[model samples]
Target: MYDSGKIIAGLIVFVLLVTFPFISNMGKASAKPKPSIDTPVINEMAVKKCVEPKEFMRAEHMQLLNNWRDSVVRNGDRIYVNTAGQSYNMSLQNTCMNCHSNKKKFCDECHNYMAVNPYCWSCHIQPKEQPNEQPKENML
Candidate 1:
């Protein structure tokens, strides 16, 4: 009990050091990370909609994609009928990646933010990047 005073001070210092980050960041305005979804392909689509609703797709896209993979690979079912009764080819490359061609912008955006390493790319080749085509001007 002779070193009780020193023990209490050391404990206080340890607690403050452990909670330093929380204390320092308290009440400070932090920038909200905005995941980019505005790719050229998506913007140019005639029907700006997915097989499912946007919120559903955002939250459960991995699960949906897994289901599609299993159906196509295991059951030989190549068609997906959404809740809206619309049928789509069960393909990650041709169907899902068709609209979301820019993996860096669309897929990577949320994945990187959430620190999720989806194994979809390990088996599937990423879609080729769409080249930016500039309009040609004719000289008289």
Candidate 2:
């Protein structure tokens, strides 16, 4: 109890130092990060769609791509039949990446938001630019 004043002052200083960042950011409006999905390839399409619906694609696109990889690479199956009874070619480069050509605009936007690094491009070859040529639908 001899140096109680000094001990209390030191404790108060430590608490403020620990909580400084939280207190400083309090009541400050944070900028909402708007992820850009609209690109030239996505625009100008008569029918803007994906293999799956927008909600499903947003949540499960990685899983669907993984399934496509397994089907094409492991099982030697080149065709992927979606839930809507539509068959699409199971090639990521030709089918998926063809439409989503701009990796920075489409893929990276969502990936960066969620902080996920999918190892898709590591193995799969990036699609070459086919400007002015709209990505053809997987019609069987």
Candidate 3:
């Protein structure tokens, strides 16, 4: 015959274990009111597409870089110009490639090992390319 005390203790423990999660979550449910479809929201900022910095370089970002390069000021004056010839005031410190040198030092070493072809070389110059190369027809 099973002990009566033992059976009662087992039933109490089982009930407590089953009820623990519900008891813990009861406070959270009462704390916040759920938002419905009719709720009014105010958003002032315009939505903009986000792109990674490396991916941005791979895309048609060369134009932006060119603009920045042209707008560099030798003096203390802060003057900037856009592609459309509009003048503005902004200071561009350096170019992107100034930091990322090679695949091993900056890009390729890591990406090559990972077997990922970063499209950055498409728009930007590769690290290994020579500064000057004669045309094939001219060479011959």
In terms of lDDT, the best-performing candidate is 1
Question: Model 3, stretches more than 4 Å misplaced?
Answer: 1-94, 128-140
**TM-score of structure candidate 1:** 0.71
Least accurate 10 contiguous residues by lDDT in model 2: 131-140
Q: How high is the CA lDDT of each candidate model?
A: 0.80, 0.75, 0.44
lDDT-sorted candidate list, best first: 1, 2, 3
What would the per-residue lDDT of candidate 3 be over residues 6-63, giving only the tens digit for each residue? 9999999999899999878776744332222121111222532112243554565545
lDDT per residue (tens digit) for residues 1-140 in model 1 = 77999999999999999999999999998654465657676789888999999999978988999998899899999989999999999999988877777676677666666667788867887666645632132111
List candidate 1 stretches off by more than 4 Å. Answer: 1-17, 20-31, 130-140
Tell me the deviation in Å of residue 17 in model 2: 10
Task: Report how far off residue 60 is in candidate 3 (Å).
Answer: 19
Off by over 4 Å in 2: 1-41, 127-140
| TM-score of model 2 (CA atoms) | 0.66
Clashing pairs in 1: none
Which candidate do you rate higher for TM-score, 2 or 3? 2
